[model samples]
Target: MSLRIAAAPPLIVPVEDLLRETGAAADEADIMRRILAEYRTTLLGDRHPLAEFRYRHMARKVVGVGSVGTRAWVILLTGRDDDDPLLQAKEAQESVLERFLEPSAHASHGERLVRGQRLMQASSDIFLGWQSIVWVDGRRRDFYLRQLQDGKGGLDPDVMTARGAALYARACGETLARAHSRSGDRVEIAGYLGSSSAFDDAITSFAEAYAEQNQRDFDALTAALDSGRLPRVPRTVEE
Candidate 1:
């Protein structure tokens, strides 16, 4: 079955205005194009249809809470006629998991993210690639590029029935299992899980505790903001 594209609110800012707001220099666009050109040649190949596409515009993309405070931008490229493609180039930093485990072997964090995504997913975006560039501020940053929301879908939990929610959960579990099986020892994992509810119950308990902890963290942050112990910046995004 084919997947549906997820619906999202518009997040466009004028190209020049975005650059100005972000403190990019006048020649930043040219620098970005050079980076894209290198990516096109190395990863996508010069024969790819997108290789001939010319850079058009770009904007600052407001990402979700998980990627909050990270630099993200959407680039527009056009080929012949009205053919346009939107690609997101998001900054990739050292993964949070690295704090607990060994550091990644991949030199570039962007490449690390792209490789992990390609390995875990059944299919990935055709434009999936990574590049590193030194910004106008002289800071080198790593970024992975992907076609924006290509064949992506999302389910709304608020509108789901009990049966639908269960089905969704099952689907999610299956997907996670498939991904893990691809990268891990399936036999070992199966032996550990073994036809028992013990593992499931343990996971349920962990999830419940995690949710309670999340709520407590949120309450603590709210209290701190209200008490002026933490500075609260108003959101500039319009509803």
Candidate 2:
């Protein structure tokens, strides 16, 4: 089957701009060392259940689009049983609540991500928690911990046909209904929807409108690049 997928979004910062923005003067190796030390000391204290697992190595890689310039580290850990794998992704500190309607940082941003993600996802990895610390520079940052590979998978939208999209949309609606039903009256919702096609039509219209807006934003970014306003970054092959 012929497949048409939308182009990926452009990077806000070009590779050169990213290097300049981060003050390339900062020793990345030294920063990693401090982050790792803080990760173990502040986030995973002596009381942590998984402290027994020995850290094998840390691999440096860039991940995420919105927070690309921030520091992120992926740490690998191994148990006495060679087959067991433990992964911890440490993201640099940024305000967790500022971006959303509900904000919370009582524990830390990392902990909040773990908590919210756990609440939304059907299944979650073990060893998810938040760690916080005051850096040597007096700046505070938070890190969230989780096993890197825990049998996670996602469908490729590019591979989805019209039929697949329709079925997926229905499944998403059912899932959302089921999630909301846990907190509200399902009988009332069923009565409101009343086996009507109106809700589906409304949702479809909204989806199309949002998709158009997304396209507009993408075009604006492209225009910025062409006008020499936005810098392009070499996409990292590794996540």
Candidate 3:
């Protein structure tokens, strides 16, 4: 009946252990509790179901390649007997495009991301929120939180046939268009794209160019590794 038992989910680790593994200082445990408490109190509020639940465990999650080096953590909370919920907090840094464009209107990066997600997604997680925490390392980091698993699904490109991949790509394009239209001037965008294969061809050409650039970057990385200019970390698998 204890969620902290040895048979607990593989991703779930003791709160203290999660902090240590994520490189937090010894006093991080207490600071983490205060941060979560404030998150629940100010963001979730007393009316939220999660407000009644207690923080039980945490898991450090690896953000994908696009978000490389950003810290993310999933916290487990338990309410009534065996009733558990997982919430993920992902670090949100300034927009990557900031260097080339105007600064974001939203001061808090986490709030900016949360607002964008709410605008783009058809239906976002009810518990989605943002918070700022002064980490043990003395840096104030922004993070956005949401329910860990939402029923999102994706097809694997590696296992897809050419035709299937084309269909999948079109579907992804449509989805992105819909999301963009919701937050942008749809009429202007539609007029710009037009009803022709020219737009498609242009997109394909750009994709091909991008793939070639990506390959060059990979080759440089490989050369660095081969010449002992870069340290290669062994891939680890956990069970």
Best by TM-score: 1
Instruction: For model 3, state the Cα shift of residue 189 in Å.
Output: 1.2
Better of 1 and 3 by TM-score: 1
Angstrom error of the Cα, residue 162, model 3: value is 3.9
lDDT of 1 by residue, 115-159 (tens): 888888888777888988886567899999988865768899889
RMSD of each: 6.5, 8.1, 6.0
lDDT per residue for candidate 3 within 1-239, as digits (tens), equals 22332433354345567557678666644666777876664353457776677766676776668878888987777888655668889999998799999999987899899889888989877788888988656789999988887577899878999999989888999899999998899999989989989998998999999999999999999999999999866544444
Query: What's the residue-level lDDT of 151 in candidate 3?
Result: 76
Off by over 4 Å in 2: 1-52, 81-83, 92-105, 150-152, 156-159, 179-198, 216-239
The candidate with the higher lDDT, 1 or 2, is 1
| Model 1 TM-score (2 dp) | 0.76
User: Quick one: how many clashes does candidate 1 have?
Assistant: 0
106, model 1: CA deviation in Å? Answer: 0.8
46 Cα displacement, candidate 2 (Å): 14
Highest lDDT scorer? 1
Clash counts for all predictions: 0, 0, 0
- By TM-score, the better pick of 2 and 3 is 3
